[model samples]
Target: MTYNLNRWQGYGHDRLYVNAGSRKIGWIDLKTGRVKVTSPAGWPSPIEGMVQQWLASNGLGHLRVKLKPRKRGDEITTQEFLDRIDRSRDDDQQPAVALSIKSQRRRSNAGTDLAKNRAGSAAYAAAQERSTWWRSLGRAMGMRTEDQAWRIGAEGEQIVARTLQWARLRGWRVLHAVPVGARGSDIDHVLIGPAGVITINTKHHSGQKVRAKPEVVFVGGAAKRYGQAAQYEANRAAKLLTAAAGRPVTVLSAVVIVGAKSVRGSRSAGVEIMPKSHLLVWLLFRRRTLSRTDVDELYELARRSTTWQPS
Candidate 1:
């Protein structure tokens, strides 16, 4: 019996693709001279196109790469396929699976709610009435209000640009505001190294006030009670990401919550929440703790970690 990597499940399917080959994974279509490849639904482009740019370490760039197709004579059984799936699933993956499920549900619910509120809240009833159909054309489908999120994200972009500049002054290349996934909201500042990838989540809530403890941080003035949400979210994001990545994607949860009074000190629920001022220094110093292999891996992983669904 022969085995196959089930593109759908990302693991071996319960049943082997027996008689399916000696199958061709990728081949140059004889008539058209076009490359024909097998790909999973999750990927947008063809497999050949997707991995075309695949490169190994050594500061080398993308060279033409392709997957070798299977021979047409192989065969595999159902039991064998299930066994392979079990064999492939590592123990560390459980956490990432859980995290992905949670995130998926949260965003799913948020999108559903947004769909329910189609009418815009403008000043006049006439505008609301006239805009009903157009309002239906636009709606949020995420946990955070997209508009506010973008504005806040823009603030974050500024902080990243400034902080990255500061880091650059100290000889660091922190890729700021790059997307880890297709969603525009899902972005992270990345530092790649042998120790793995460290993705930073930046939040800018200026002039609120700052109070901190290891378990949580409170950033606001009045009856202000900021929970450990940001830190928790960061930690969760890291864990989930590591799992989804199917490798040891080391993640460091961080928050740069800007506020009045040039904040000082450091604390985390399980992360490092600090001022934007501290980010450059912390990252610069942390650079010493990693290795060259880590740097390369981090850079690649940062680019690949983005996950998205096709509409």
Candidate 2:
């Protein structure tokens, strides 16, 4: 016997909603063709088995039916089902779902560290208190260019992080703000997957025009050392990871320019320069160089503190 299925709007796309004489029964995914039984308790075992047989005969036997327990006074209307689907879709679209970065348990606060060191110095403390108002006034007047620069950089890193989180859906592993070297410098992000390893350096240049040549990158008509820096970061990561894994690790460098009005650059100075929006697509299409095992090994090594610390 053929079962009539009604198409209903689901979280990401359309789904097939099953009904038995106006009573809601279950739903099936339109894309994956997966079936779900909503009111399993309401239907008798014989009827459920028959329905399952019918679905299997209709070429849906490959997918397993998800059974949900029936609750008292629990009636699922079409509108309620649609609402639940919408909520699920929204949750799937969140960036945090894909961005799997292992966070450090004990984090270092640089500002707090500095403050602690100055606690015993009365003169420095008095000076710091007195300059607080002047500093605030300067910040209010937009004279704190250094602070603004740091804020822009931080914002760019966050955008890259969100983008990397989305990449997790495509089988990419990402670690953000990874500390390396002895001077407290950090690699903005490290990505490992089928495409091998990549060290991403985020540069936030809002409303600025960027141009890249073979050896130099110009931002807003001023030459910047972004390409050289990215290459150095990649090399450093490769050296550290190679030693930790006891195998050769090839690291590619990518510089993500955020909020640039226009970016005119390709691979120069062993670094790939692109705008923030295109980073995901670029990473997805790269030739696969590492297997799942290699990716996992590299990711674990990158996450360890000893891997980055100087010998």
Candidate 3:
């Protein structure tokens, strides 16, 4: 099959993205001559030969190495591929290139958060159920269920969301309750700005002690995988945004603990775990990485519902 090649000049490296119709099959690194086949369709011998022919015709035959696809993915559904391609085209057709700095700044103020408040809604429902006299008696008697946990979780998310609002005033973009895949799973909060992208996971432990080690976190003496989950969310976000922007994107993960009586220990893996009180301070102290223009571009791309939709 014939493929379209688009040259992307990145920092210290250049790549040629290969697209078959609307689907991104793979990409080739010009610096290392490495072929990274992202989709399975690009693995066949015929497709590799075609890529080689293109390299040879362009006077870069020396860069055509063996067909060893380092990465493989199952992201080639016709409907989803076409949908993403159409969204990409729409974005290109109506880019923010002509917008003046003032206008771009104004645009960033709109829709600062995208959460649907699913947890809050559920928490409200649970509260309503407990409002009855009989239910109130049960609650006062110290009876609870897993469903009641939503209330505490929702409260924590609200606290964290409020704290993140400060970042937007400084040209940072924040997205709350970022829905991931078709399942009901979601990333608690996403902060993008000069300090780069961070996926935040909120954990609520009312008056409980918490500690973070290099691998896991201990909540009231119970080991939890909060750090790993935050990291996973960050990784997924990095992958999605990288594909959408057609460039490399890095993501950081953080876990915010709300109502914790005391917090001890260090960061978990590559994830940062801290109490809610320190979230704003920690965020503000991060080193600046992206310019105003880059932040706006990435924010626009990320805010799109289609960008976070399942593939």
Candidate 4:
């Protein structure tokens, strides 16, 4: 069968995708020469030869040495398979499992409405409270304290949740105040959509400037571990979802700063960083990486309270 080759230049490396008409067959990583085939029909006989010829013609023959070919009938996990869905097509096909997902979402939403696991609920619960009436009055008088930090953090998460309403209207599913691990920690927001899964860390630094380096972020000149925390959460979520789905799921991370006067950074130290205002635009414009079917199946697995509990 004849195939087409397309090259996409990414952040640091380039990818050569092999497609059979509209279906994505696989891709060749130009830097590593590692070939990954997602075709269920198995490795086609002519694909390797076609790839070799394309590389040679395009002056990428050096990558030939690193090529590791897979045997016919080799299978990839469900997660990898879903991630390999065609990016160019806006296919709205739903997975068979989606029928049950609708019920699950209804239950999850019911729980959310009761504030059982709603957005910012965890942060709001964790916020320190003034024991004395006088202390509450002191806080009302513009006192700065640890309680204030948590208060604003919860508010920031709520703001981001409102913004994510925009995402839901665009066919994306979002979860807020996801409880993670057994340490009483929680993820601010989790987004599932055409752009795949993302764990968002929301920070509110009202009237403060936020700056980021590759690995660290600064809020009002105070360095914080937002990047590392977000990446860690993404990794954990990926592992949990992969196990539940019986596949290798991939997750992305992002840090959204709310109420910041300005944001100065671009690179994601394993996570994307942006102000809350840009979150919607960034998510809406990202290349389509998941289909309606993929999103539904994953969201089905993610919304379960059991999914986040310690194993």
Candidate 5:
């Protein structure tokens, strides 16, 4: 629970909203359009200055909370979260969710952090690809646009489809990897059962260290490994989907390499962390059934989050 102060009450019919970290919280009854910081003294964060700087630079004057720092040596606990909320003064209390009255602002600063990743990275779902000034190059010969990652992140849909095929041959339903929300923005694998939804994230890592189970490796002493990245992605996806679905979505992420023929690690989850020399064999073994609803959801979700390159 977060405590918010209603300093925005007198905006006079203008709508407003605030961005809290990765999740956006809409404001209530005021303009939701971006504004600069007129007042700032609520949350506790080390990056307050940076946050203020960012908001101002983006033409966003008004600002709110941004980070959730864990203690010196502790992970964020529910008790701690509630305690922090309870202890904070409510001179102006803001709800976790905000409803605003301004027009939704278009994100338009410049140079996105996405510039720092695989084109196919899931970081920014609906980002427009960068543009070129070739048409205007003759007018300004020295002008140059930074190059974007030519390799778009792997399509989550392709990855999910492959999982469905792989799990089916084993007489199991690929239940948990579907998208279920109004916009289906949150992506996750959902295997709905009488017990509940079991979320699974299928990954394709090239390294030979079975990321899920790190013990099995024959490489140069686990040289540069994929640490908590896959799990972190899976966990985040689960949380978002859970919020969207209005319930907990159990999550399990597995790295299923399509080609690591040189792998020599033992399978931690009964599967080699290495890639298969023959991609066909890997697919054949993962055949599994899924409810039509789940399949449709996954496909639709994938479509929204994914597209294709015509071969």
Candidate 6:
């Protein structure tokens, strides 16, 4: 009653080895329900009857079983055959449910740290009693408070999020302030839709000129690694999502400059730089690369905080 099963590498469909003792007597084409007997010359009638009965009980009685010559090295152990069948079945089945992600309680510490620094600076100035007037003047001129940096970044993220909200109407899903890695690094926004997944990095420079040229971005008059950072974020997101999806997931990178006096750039270093007003239009008109199913699965993976955290 032992069975030796082996996958038919030649066949394009599911093929199971029907074994008796240590020999392969036949192969059952599970997909077509057509059984082929390889060693029919001395095959036991009882074993054949049993196979036929099993197939009939399995609603494959309509299939015709025929005799054929045995191929070399077709014999395999019962356990091996069973394992092969199990793997084949697993490969054919789709996931019954989506992965459940646990909610993360961690909030952004960057904003809090900035606020603390601002408070500390003001207290230090007050204690000095001499530089207090200059510090107060600096504060009035927007120099004493370093918290403006965080506030500006947060404002840019909010603007990008609001702009991306239009994507929901177009069957897209957007996740804002997605935390990544053990460090405080985060993707400002992620958009998943028919066009594919895009990781957005927001830069807010009010009334400042922005310029980008292949691998370099300049805000106001200072150079920054905005393009490189966007590319890195996109790559990290794609890797995490590919693992979660059990398949390849492509991710694109973008940089949105909010309230910039002017924007001038092409896709430099694989990251697109543009004003916030154009983000929605760019996303909406890109060539569709994902279907509705892909969008749903990718969105689920992107929304999961655990996906980006190190194991």
Error of 2 at 154 (Å): 0.7
At residue 109, give the lDDT of candidate 6. 16
- Alpha-carbon runs more than 4 Å astray in model 1: 1-153, 166-173, 178-185, 194-196, 222-227, 230-246, 287-289, 305-311
- Rate residue 116 of model 1 by lDDT: 19
Better of 2 and 5 by TM-score: 2
| C-alpha RMSD for every candidate | 16.7, 15.2, 13.3, 13.1, 19.7, 16.7
If both were scored by TM-score, which would come out higher, candidate 4 or candidate 5? 4
Instruction: Write the number of the candidate with greater lDDT, choosing between 2 and 4.
Output: 4
Best candidate, TM-score: 4
lDDT of 3 at 58: 80
Q: Best candidate, lDDT-wise?
A: 4
**How many clashes does each candidate structure show, in the order listed?**
14, 1, 0, 0, 56, 1
Which pairs of residues collide in candidate 6?
5-81
- The residue-by-residue lDDT of candidate 1 on 184-251, one tens digit each, is 33434554543334556656665666766665565653322232554444455465545544544445
**lDDT per residue as tens, model 6, 1-311:** 56554544221345656677776565666665444544533333345456666667867666555332123334343234335445544776422111112111112111222111211232233334434566557768869344445555676777676777688899888776666787666677778899988888888889999998887898888988888888988998888877766677788999888898999986668789899988889988999988664675466456666776757
Output the lDDT of residue 259, model 1.
Answer: 43
Question: Which stretches of model 2 miss by more than 4 angstroms?
Answer: 1-133
Candidate 6 ranges with C-alpha deviation above 4 Å: 1-141
Q: Model 5's lDDT to the true fold?
A: 0.36
Off by over 4 Å in 3: 1-140
- Stretches of candidate 5 off by over 4 Å are 1-222, 266-311
Q: Candidate 5: minimum summed lDDT over ten consecutive residues — where?
A: 102-111
Candidate scoring better on TM-score of 1 and 3? 3
**For residues 1-311, what per-residue lDDT tens digits would candidate 2 score against the true structure?**
24355654421345666667665555556455444454433222233345456567767666544333233244453334445545545775421111111111112111121111211132223334445566667878878544445555666787777788789998898877676766757777788999989988888888999998888899999988888989998988888888776667889999988898999977568689999889999999999998664675466567666678868
Provide the TM-score for each candidate, comma-separated.
Answer: 0.44, 0.58, 0.60, 0.62, 0.31, 0.57
User: Against the hidden true structure, what lDDT does model 3 obtain?
Assistant: 0.69
